[model samples]
Target chain A: MTSILEVNNLTKTYDQFSLDRLSFSLQKGCITGFIGVNGAGKTTTIKSILGLINPEAGSIRFDGMEMNRQEKQIKNRIGFVLDEGYFYGMLTVKEMKNVIAPAYSSWDEQTFSNWIGRFGLNPNQKIASLSTGMRMKFAVALALSHHADLLIMDEPTSGLDPMMRSELMAILLDFMKEEGKSVFFSTHITSDLDKVADMLILIDGGKILLNEEKDTLLDNHARIKGDSRWINERTRPLFLTLRETPYGFEGLTHQKEALRQEMPDAVFERPTIEDIMLAYVGGAEIAH
Target chain B: MLINLVIKDFMLMKKYLLFLVLFALAAPIVIASQTKDDSLLFLMPFYLIMITEIATYLQVSKFESISRGAAFICATPYTRRTFIEAKYLFVFVTFVGILFAQIVASFLLPSLKTGLNLNAVGAAFLMVSLLFGVLIPCQIKFGFDVVRWIFFGLAFLIPFSLGPILRWYQSLGIHFSFSLPVSQTGQILLMYVFAVVITFVSMYASIKIYEKKDL
Candidate 1:
C-alpha cells in the first residue's frame, strides 16, 4: 500500500522534554492510531506534521509533497481536529463556517449542511454553547466538508463519553469507506482504536516503541499465567513483564511458542491493546 | 485568502465595531454640547478614532489568544506571512474607514468643521500609524498578554508624567523651536510618507517574528 503521510527523523526539543528522532507513517486508506501517555510528545508530533510548530530537524511529507516547501498546497489537502475545539466561540455555527469556508478552495456548503443536519447542530447556535461532543462533531464536519484527503486529529476522543467516542469511531469508519482517505488519530484511549484502527504506533518518552499492524501485533503477543516455580532466570528473561502473587504468576511475552514448549501448563490468552501498551511502557519504566 | 482572513477578523469584532460606531457618532455631539469647548469638540473625534483602532486591535489579539484561534488559522491553507499581512491590512483599513466616517460627520456639524484641517488630519494619521507601528511589532515579540499590560501601563504613565517631564525639561534651561523649509502640503505629505514607511517596517518585523513562533 502507498503511504499518505511520512515523517523521518522528526526532532523537536524543549528545556524539559524532546522528540528524539521520532518517525512514523500512515498508509493510504488506513486508520493509524497514535498512542502515548500524557506529555509524551503526541501533540508536538502532530503540531510538527501540521506546521503549527517548527521542528529542530526532520522532513514531513504528505502525499509526496514536502510540508515546509509546499506548505500551503499541502495544508489545503489536509484537515485537523485538535483535542480542544479552537474555534471562534462568539460566532454562530454558520457565521464561523462563513469565515472558514473561504479559506478552503474545495469547501462544499451542501456537504457541510448535510453534516450539520446529521450531527443535529443548530447553525444559529454560538460555538461556545455547543457541548464537547457537539464541538468535536462540528470539527469533523468541517474537516470532511473541505474534501480533505487526510485527517490529523489530536486526541479527538479525549474528555468524551463512551457513547460519543463510539459515534466518533463510526464517523471515522464511515469516512474510511472512500478511496485514498487516511486518518492519523492520536489518543491514549486504546479501546477506540481496537474497533477501527488498522495500524498502531505506540510512543513513549518522545520515542516510538512499536509500529505494526494491529492484528499482527495482537497475534504476536500473549498473556501467560502459570505457577511462579516455572519462572526461572532463563524463563524470566523471556517475559516482557511479570507480576507475582502468593498463588500464581502472570506475565506478558511475545515468545509464546517458546514459552509453551518450556512450560506446558501455562495459560495463553489474547492481550488487549491496553495490555500491550502497558507492557511496553511499564516495562520500559522498569528498565529505566 | 488574505481578504478572507481580514474578513474573519472583522466578523470576530463586529459587535465591538457596532459599539464603536455608535460612540463615534454620539460621543462628540454630547461632549461638544456639555463642554461648549471648540477644542474639546476637535479632540474628541480624533480621540474616539484612536480608541476604536486600539480597541479593535486589542480585541482581535485577545480573542485569538483566548480561543487559540491563531493555531486554528495557521492550520488552514493561509501561510504565516498571509496571517500577518491580513492583520496589518485589517487595522489599516479600519483606521481609514473610521477616519473617513469622522470626516463625513465633521462636515454636518459647524462646530467641528474648524478642526478638520490638513494639519489635524496629518497629525492624527501620523500618531495612530506610529503608535500601531511600534505596538504591532511589540505584540508579535512579547505575545498579547505581555503587550496588553505594557500598553495599559504606558497609557497611564504618559499622561501622568507629561507635566513633570515638561517641568524637568524647563529646569534644563533649554528652549526648542523649529520651522521646516516646506509648504504646509509638503509637510503633511512628508508625514504621510513617514507613516507609510513606519507601517511597512513594522509589518516586516511582525512577519519575521511570527514566522518562527511556535503556536
Candidate 2:
C-alpha cells in the first residue's frame, strides 16, 4: 500500500519535553489510530505534520511530495479537525461557513450545507453557544465539506461521551467510503479504534512504541492470567509485562504458546488493542 | 483565501459597525459645537480615523482568542504568511472603509466639510499607518498578550506623558518651530509615499516573524 504520509526522523524540542527522532507513515485509504497517553506528543506530531509547528530535523512527505516544498498544495487536500472548534464566537454558523469556505479550492457549498443540516446545527446560532459535542460536529462538517482527501484529527474524541464518539466514528466511516481518502485519528479511546481502525500506532513519551496492522498487533500478543508465583526471573523476560494484583498475577506476551508450555496452569487469551497498549505503557510507568 | 479571511474579520466586526458609524458622525458634531474655528473641524475625520483605527486594532486580537481560532486557521490550507497577509489587508481595507465613510459623512454634515483638509487627512494617514506598521508585526510575533502592553504604552502612556513633557519644555523656556518647504500637495504626496513604504516594510517583517512562530 502506498503511504499517504511518510514522517522520517522527526524531532522537536520544548523546555519541558522533546520528540526524539520519531518516525511513522500513514497508509493510503486506511484509518490509522494514533493511540497515546496524555502528553505523549501526539498533538505535537500532528501539528508538525500540518506545519503548525516546525521540527528541528526530519522530513514529512505527503502523497510523494515533500511537505516543506509544497505545503500549500499539501494542505489544500487535507482537512483538519482540532480538539475544539476554532471559530469566531460572535458570528453565526452560516457566517462562519462563509468565512472559511473560500480558503479551500474544493469547497462545496451544498456539501457544507448538507452536513450542517445533518449535524443539526442551526445556521443562525452563534458558534460560542454550541456544546463541546456540537462544536466537534461543526468541525467535522467543515472538514467533510471541503472535499479533502485526508482528514487529520488531533484528539478528536477525547472528551466525548460514548454515544457521541460512536456518532463521530460513523461520520468518519462514511467519509472513507470514497476511495483515496484516509483518516489519521488520534485518541486515547482504544475501544473506538477497535471498531474502525485498520492500522494501529502506539506512541509513548514522544516515541513510537508500536506501528503495525491492527490485526497483526492483536494476533502477536496475548493476555496471560495465573498465580503470582508463576512470575519468576526465568519466565519474567518471556512476558511482555508481569504485574501482580491482590487476586493474582496477569501479564501480556507475544510468545503465549511458549509461556503456556512453561506455566501449564496459566490461562492465555487473545489480547485486545487496549490490553497490548496497557501492557507496554502501563508496565513502563510502574517500572519507573 | 485571503479575501475569505478578511470577510470573516468584517463579519466579526459587524456588531460594532453601526455603533462606530454613529460615533463617527456624532463625534465631529460635538467637537465642532465646542470649537469656535470651523476649520479645526477638519480634524474630525482625522480624529475619527485615529480612534477607530486603535479600536479596530484592539478588536483584531479577539478573533483568535475565541475558540483558539488562530490554531484553527493555521490548520486550514492557508499558510501562516497568508494569515498575516489577510490581517494586513483587513487593516488596509478597514482603513479605506472608514476613510470613505468620513468623506461621505463630511459631505452630508456641513461642519465637517467646512473643516476638511486633504493635506491634514493625508498626514493623519501617515501617522496611523506608521503606528500600525510597528504594531502588526509585534502582535503577530509575540501574540496579543505581550503586544497588549506595548499597545498600552502607545495608546495611553505616550499620549498622557506628552502633557508633562510640554509643561517641562515650557518651564525650560525652550521653543521649536519648523516650516514645510513644499506645497500642500507635495507634502501630502510625500506622506502617502512614506506611509506606503512603511506599510510594506511592516508587512514583510510580519510575514517573516509569523513564518517562524510555533503556533
Candidate 3:
C-alpha cells in the first residue's frame, strides 16, 4: 500500500505544551484511527498536516506533494471535518454550501444533494438551529461531496449519540468502498474505530507508542488476569501496565504467549484498542 | 474563491442591509433639515462613509472571531493571500457602493449635488483610506481586543487631547498655516494615486502579518 499522507519530524512548541517531532503515515484506501488521550497532540499533528499551523520544523507530504509547497492543490484533494462546526452559524445550509462549493474544483451538487437527503438535513435551516449530531452530519456530507481522496477528521464523533455515531461509521465504510479513498480521524471513542478502522495509531504524551494494523495490534496485545503472585520481579517487565487488587491482579502485555507459558494458571484475554491505549497512556498510574 | 469569500461576507451582513437602506433614505432628509448650504450636504455621506466603514469592520471582525471562521477559512483550500485579498477588495467594493449610492441620490435630489468638487471628495477618500490603512492591519494582526481599544482610544483621546496639544504647540512658538494651493485635475489625480498606494501598502502588510499568524 502507498501512503496518501506522510508526516515526518513535525514539531510545534507552545509555552505549556509541545508536539514533539511527531511522525505518522496514512496509506491509501485505509481508515487509520488516531487514538490519544486528551492533549496527546493528535489535533496538533492534524493541523500540521493541513498547514493550519506552520510547524517549527519538519515536513508534510500529501500524495507525494510537499504540503507547504503545494498547499492549495493538496488541500483541494483533502477534506477536513473539524471537531466543532467551523462554519458560520447564521448561514442556512444552502447558503453555507454555496459559500464552500466554489472553493473545490470537483464539488458535486448531485452527491451533495444525495448526502443531504440521506442525512435528512434541510438546506434552508440555519446551521445554528441544528443539533450537534446534525451539524456533524452536515460537515461530513460537505466533505464527501467534493470528490476528495482523503478525509481527515478531528474528533468528529466526540459528542454524538449511538445511532448517529453508527450512521456516521456506516457512511465512512461506504465512502471507503470506492477506489483510491482513505480516512484519518482522531477520536477518543475506540469502539467506533473497532468496527471500522483498518489501521490503528496510539499516541501518548506527544509521542507515538503504537502504529499497526488494527487486527494485528489487537492480536498481538493481551490482557492477563490472575493471582498477584504471577507478577514477580522477573516477570514485571513483561506487563505493559499492571494493576493489583486484594484478591488478584490484572495487566496488559504484548508477549502474551511467552508470559502464558510462564504463568500457566493465568487467564489471558484479548486486548481491545482501549486496553492497548490505556496500557500505553495509563502506564504510570497502573504500574505496580 | 476570493469572490465566494466576499459573497460569504455579504451573506453574513444580510441583517445589516436593511439598516443600510434606511440610512440611505434617511441621510438625505437629515442633512437637508440640518444644513441650509446644499454644497455641505455631500459631507453627510462622507461622515456616513466613516461610520459605515467602521461599523462593517466591527461587524465582520466580531463575526470572524466569534464564529472561529478564520479556522474554517484557514483549513480550506484558500491561500492566506487570497483571504486577505478578498477582505481588501470587499472594503473597496463597499466604499464604492456607498459612494455610488450617495452620488446617485445627490443627482436625484438637486439640492444634494455638490458639482463634483474634487477637493471634498478627494479629501474624504484619502481620509477613509488612511483610516482603513491603520485599522485593518491592526485588527488582522492583533485581533478584536486590540482593535477595540485602539478605536476607543482614538475616538476619545484625539478630541480630548486636541485643545491641550494645540495650546502646547502654540506655547512652543510653533505656528502653522491652514491653507490649500489652487486645485487642478492633476493634483486630484495625484491624491488618488497616493490613496491607492497607501491602501495597497497596508494590504500587503496585512497579508504578511496574516500569513505568519498561527490561527
Candidate 4:
C-alpha cells in the first residue's frame, strides 16, 4: 500500500522547544494513532504536515506531491479536523454547509446531512451554541463528507465522553470498511487509540520514540515490574525507556522473554499503549 | 476553493457591514437640519467612521476568532502571498462597495443642506486605501497585538499633537479646498487608479511576506 502522507526529516525549532528531525508516514486505509503528551510536538508535527507551520528543514509529501508547493492539489484530497471547530460563531450549521460545500469539488451534501443526522446535530443550530462534543462531531462530519481520501485530525476525541468516543470509533471503523480512506488522528487518550488505531506512533520530546503496528508494539513492549534493584544489566536488554520508583522499576522493553529467562523473580506483563507512552513521556513529576 | 472561502467571509460580514454603511448614510439624513458646511460635516465623519470600522473588522474578524493561531490560515492550500492578496483585494472591494453605496445615497437623499463634493469621495477612497496598505503590512510584520499598540499610540498621539504636522502642511501650501489645483477628470481617474494599483502591489508584497512568516 502507498503512503497517503509522508513527513521526512521534519525539523522545527523554537527558543525553548524543537522538533528534532521528525519523520513518519501513514498508509492508506488504516487508523494511525499519533500519541504524545502536551508540548511533545504532536500539534507541531500536525501543523508542519498541514503546511500550517513552516519547518526549518525537510518536507511533507501527500500522494507524492510536495506539500508546500502543491498545497492546493494535496489539500484537495486531505481533510483536516482541528481540535476545536473553526467557523464563524454566528453561522448556522446549514450556512456552514452551504458555504464550505462548494470549496470541495466532490463535497457530498447528502453524506454531510447523513453525518449530521447520525451525530444528532441540529443543522439550524448556531455554531456558538453547540457543545464542544457536538462541534467535534460536526468537524468530523465535515472532514468525512468532502470525499477526502485522507483525514488528518487533531485531538478529535479529547473532549468526547466515553459513549461519544465509542460512537466516533464506530463511525471511523465503518468509514474504513470502504476502500481507499485513511485516518491519521492525534490524541492523548490512549484508550481511544487502543480501540481504533491500527498503528501507533509514540512521540515525546520533539521526536518520534516508536512507530510500529499497534499489535506489534503492544506485543513487544512488556512492562517488567519488581524492586528497583531488579533493574540490572541482565534485565536491561534493548529496553526502550526506563522508569524507576522507590517501590519498583518499570522498564519498557521488547526483550521481555530474555529478561524473564534471566530474572525469574521479575513479573513481566504485556504493556498497554498507555503504559509504553507514559514510560516515554514520564518525567520526575509524573512518576509520583 | 479560496474564492469560495472568500465568499463565505463576505457573507458573514454582510449584516455588520450593511448596518455600518446604512448608519453612516442616516447620519447626514438625520443632520440635514445642520446650518453649517453640511457637505464637509456629512462626508468626513461618514468616511472616517465607515473606514475605521472596515479596517477594524478586517483586523479583528468580528465574526469569529480561531485559537489555533494565525498559522491556521497559512497551513491551508492558499499561500501567505495569495492569502494576503485576497485580504487586500477584499478590503479594496469593500472600499469600492462603500463608495458606490454612499455615491448612490448622496444622490437619492435630500441635499446635505450642503451639496456633496465628488472630489472628497475620491480623496476619502485614497485615504482608506492608504490606511489599509500601511496597517496590513504593519499587522503582517508585528502581529495583531503589537500592531494594535503601535496603531493606538500613533492614533492617540497624532490627534493630540498635530500642530507641527499641520504647520508643515501649511508651509507646503497644501489645502483640501477645490480652489487649490484639483486634478482634472482624467488626472483624477489616473490618481485613483495609481493609488489603487500602489495599494494592490503593497498588499501583494505583504502577502508574500506573510507566506514566509513563521506563523
Candidate 5:
C-alpha cells in the first residue's frame, strides 16, 4: 500500500525533553493511531508534521512531496484538529468558518453547511459558547469541508465523554469509507483506537516503541496468568510486565507460545491495546 | 490568502474598532468644545489615528495569544510570510481607514477642519510606523503580555526618569545641537522614506523571529 505521510529521523529538542529521531508513516486509506503517554512528544511530532514547529532534523513527505518544499500545497491537502480548539472564542461559528474557508482553495460551502446542520451547531453562537464536543464537531466540520486527503488529529477526543468519543470514532470510520483518505490520530486513549485504528504506532520517551498492524500486535501479545511461583528469574525475562497477587501472577508477553511450552499450565487471554501500551510503558515494575 | 488573514484580524477586532471609531469621532468634538483650542483640533486626528492603531494592535495580539490562533494559522495553507504580510497590510489599511474617517468627519463638522495638511499626515504616519516598528517584533519575541507590561513600565518610567536623565546628561558635561540643512518638503519626503524603511525592517525582523519560534 502507498504511504500517505512519512517521517524519517524527525528530531526536535527542548531543554528538559527531546524527540530523539522518531520515525513513522501512515499508509494510504488506513487509520494510524499514534499512542504515547503524556510528555512523550506526541504533540511535538504532530506539530513538526504540520510545520507548526521546525524540527532540528528530519524529512516529512506527504503524497511523495517534501513538506518544506511544498508546504502550502502540502498543507492544502492536509487537515488538522488539534487537542484544543485554538479558535477565536469571540467569533461566531459561521464567522469563524468565513475566516478559514477563504484560506483553502477547495473549501465547500455546501458541505460545511451540511456538517453544521448535522452536528446541530448554532452558526450564530460564539465558539466559546459551544461545549467541548460541539467544538470538536465544528473542528471536524472545518477539516472535512476543505476536501483534504489526510486528517491529522491530536487527541481530538481528550476531555470528551465516552459518547462523544464514540461519535468521533464513527466520524473517522465514515471518513475512511472514501478511497485514498487516511487519518493519523494521536491519543493516549487506546480504547478509541481499538474501535477504528488499522495500524498502531506506540511512542515512549520521544521514541517509537512499536509500529505494526493492530490485530497482529494484539495476536502477538497475550495476558498470561499462572501461579506466582512460576515467575522465577528464568521466566521473569519473558514477560514485558508482571504483577503478582496472593492467589496468582498475571503478566503480558509477546512470547506466549514459548512460555506455554515451558509452563503448560499458564492461562492465556487476549490483550487489549491498553494492556499492550501499559506493558511497554510501565516496564517491569514489581506489583504486590 | 494574505487578504483573508487580514480580514480575519479585522473580523476579530470589528467590535473594538467600532467602539474606537465612535470615540475617535465624538471625543474630538467634545474636547474641541471644552478646551476651545483650534490647534488641538489639528492634533486631534493624529491622536485619534494613533489611539485607533494601538488599540487595534492590542486587541488583535490579546485575542491571538488567548485563543492560540497564531498556532492555528500555522496549520493553514498560508505561509508565515503571508501571515506577517497580512499583519502589515492590516495595520496600514487601518491607519488609512481612520484617516479617511477623520477627513469625512472634518467635512461634516466644519469646526473640526483645522487645515489637516500633508505635513501632519506624514508626521502621523511616521509616528505610527515607528511605534509599531518597535512594538510588533517585541510582541512576537516576548509575547503580547510581556510587551504590554514593558509598555506600561516605560510609560511610568519615562516621565519620572526624564528629569534625572537630563541631570545625568548635564553631569556628563556634554552638550550637542545639530540642525538638518533640508527644505520642508525634503524633510517630509525623508520622514516618509524613513517610515517605509522602518516598516519593512520591522516586518523582516518579525518574520525571522516568528519562523524560528516554536509555537
Candidate 6:
C-alpha cells in the first residue's frame, strides 16, 4: 500500500528539546493516532512535517512530493489544525467562511455550511465568544471543507469535553471512509484514538518508541495482573515493564502471547493504547 | 499559493484594519488640533508606517514562539519565502497607497495644505524607512514585535543623532540649502520611480533572507 505521508530520518533541535531521526508513515485510507505524553515531541514532529520548524536532517514526503523542493505544491494538498489556532476574534462564523474559503482552490461552501449544520453551530456568532468545544469543531469543519488529501491535527482534543471529542472522532471516522483522505492526529487523549485510529505512533523523549497498527500494538501485547512468580516465569525479560506494589505486581509485555501458555495462572488481559504507551514511556514508574 | 497567502493576510488584516486606518488618519489630526505643530502634519507618513507594521504583525507573523499550537501560516501551502515577500510587498504597497492619499489630501486640506516637496534626500530616506525599518528586519527576525522593536528603536534615535548636524549649521552661520537637480515634474516622477524600485529590491532581499532563515 502506498503511504500518504512519509517522514524519513527526521531530526530537529531547540536549545532544550530535540527530535532525533524520527521516521514514520501514514497510509491512505487509514487514520494514525500520533500518541505521546506531554513533552514527548508529538507537536515537534507535527511541526516538522508541516515545515513550520525546519528539520536539521530529514526528508518529509507528502503524497510522494519532497516537502522542501515543492513546498507550495505539497502544502496545497494538506490541511492542518493546531490546538490553539483560534480564528480572528472579530470574525463571525459566516464571515470566516467568506474570508478563509478562497485560500483553498477546492473549498466547497455547501460542504462547509452542511458541516456547520451538522455541528449545530450558529453562522453569525463571533469566534471569540464561542466555547472551546465550538472553536475546535469549527476548526475541524474548516479543515474538511478544503479538498485536502492529508489532515494533520496536533492535540486537537485536549480541551474538548467527552461528548465533543466523541463527536469529533465520529466526524473524523466518517472522513476516513473516503478513499483518498487520511488523518494524522496527535493527542494525549488515548481514549479518543481508541475507536478511530487504525494505526498508533508513540513517541517519548524525542524518539519514536512504537509505531504499528493499533490492533497489532494492542493484540500482540497484553497486560498481566498477577504475582512476581508468574511474572518471573512468564515475562519476556527484555520487554517487561513491570509495576510492583505491596500486595502484588502487574505490568505490560510485548511477548504476552508467548508467555500466556507458560503461566496459566497469570491473568493476561488485552491492552488498550494507553496501557501500552504508559508502560513504555512511563518506564521509570512501571519498571520493576 | 502566493495569492491565497496574500488573501489570508488580508483576512487577518481585515479584522484589525478598521482601527488601524482610523488611528493612522486621526492621530496627526489630534496632534494638529492640540499642538498646532505644523511639522506634526508632515509626520503623518510615520504614523502610516507604524500602522502598516502593526497590521503586518496582526495579519502575518504574529507568534514569537513557533509551535504547532499557534502555527497557521507556517502550515499552509505558502512557503517561508513567499510568506515574507507578501509582508514586505504589502508594506510597500501600503506605503504607496498612503503616499498617494497624502498627496491628494495635501491639496484638499486648507489649514494643512502644501505642495509635495519630495527631493533626492527625502526619497532616499523613504527608501530607508521602507527597507531598513519595515522590510529587512522583518525578513531577518521573522517575529513582528522583535523586528519592529529593534528597527523602531534605532529609527527613534535618528532625530537625536541629527542634533550635531543641526548644531553645525547653527554654529558656523553657514546656511545649507538643498534641491534635487531636476525640474519639479522630473523630481516628482523620479522619486515615485525610486520608491517603486527600492520597494522591489527590498522585497527581493526579504525573500532571500526568508528562504535562508533557520526555521
* Top DockQ model: 1
Estimate, for each residue in B1-215, the C-alpha lDDT of model 6 and write its tens digit. Answer: 45555554555557566776665455544555676565655555555555565555544555323322124655665556666666655555555555555555545454434223454335534654555445465636566567656657767887787898788869999866899888888876776776667767767776666554554
- Give the C-alpha miss distance for residue A85 in model 3, angstroms: 1.0
Q: Evaluated with lDDT, which candidate comes out highest?
A: 5
| Clash count, one per candidate | 0, 1, 0, 1, 0, 0
**What local lDDT does model 4 show for residue A116?**
92
Q: Score the docking of each candidate (DockQ).
A: 0.77, 0.70, 0.73, 0.40, 0.76, 0.37
State each model's CA lDDT, in order.
0.87, 0.84, 0.85, 0.73, 0.88, 0.72
TM-score of chain A, cand. 2:
0.95
lDDT of 5 by residue, A1-288 (tens): 999899999999899989999888899999999998998889999999988898999999999999989998999999899999888998999888887888899999999999999999999999999998999999999999998999999999999999889989998999999999999999998999998999999998899999999999999999999998888877888889888889999889999888998789999999999999988887656421
Model 5: per-residue Cα lDDT over B99-182, one tens digit each: 877777777677777736777888899999999899989888888899889877877998899999999999999879877899
Sliding window of 10 residues with minimal summed lDDT for model 6 chain A: A231-240
Candidate 4 clash pair list: B81-B207
- The residue pairs found clashing in candidate 2 are B42-B115
lDDT of 1 by residue, A90-203 (tens): 889988888778888899999999999999999999999999999999999888998899999999999899999999999999889999999999999899999999999999
Report each candidate's C-alpha RMSD, comma-separated, in the order given.
2.2, 2.3, 2.3, 4.0, 2.7, 4.3
The model with the greater DockQ, 2 or 4, is 2
User: Which residues of candidate 5, in runs, are more than 4 Å off?
Assistant: A286-288, B34-39, B157-186
The DockQ assigned to candidate 6 is 0.37
Which residue pairs does candidate 5 place in steric collision?
none
User: How is the predicted docking of candidate 5 categorized under the CAPRI scheme?
Assistant: medium
Sequence-dependent TM-score of model 6: 0.82
- For every candidate, the chain B TM-score is 0.90, 0.87, 0.85, 0.72, 0.86, 0.65
- Give one digit per residue, the lDDT tens place, for model 1 in B4-67: 8888898888888888777776666666667777677667656866888888899988888788
Model 3: residues >4 Å from true position, as ranges? B115-118, B158-183
Per-prediction TM-score, please? 0.94, 0.93, 0.94, 0.85, 0.93, 0.82
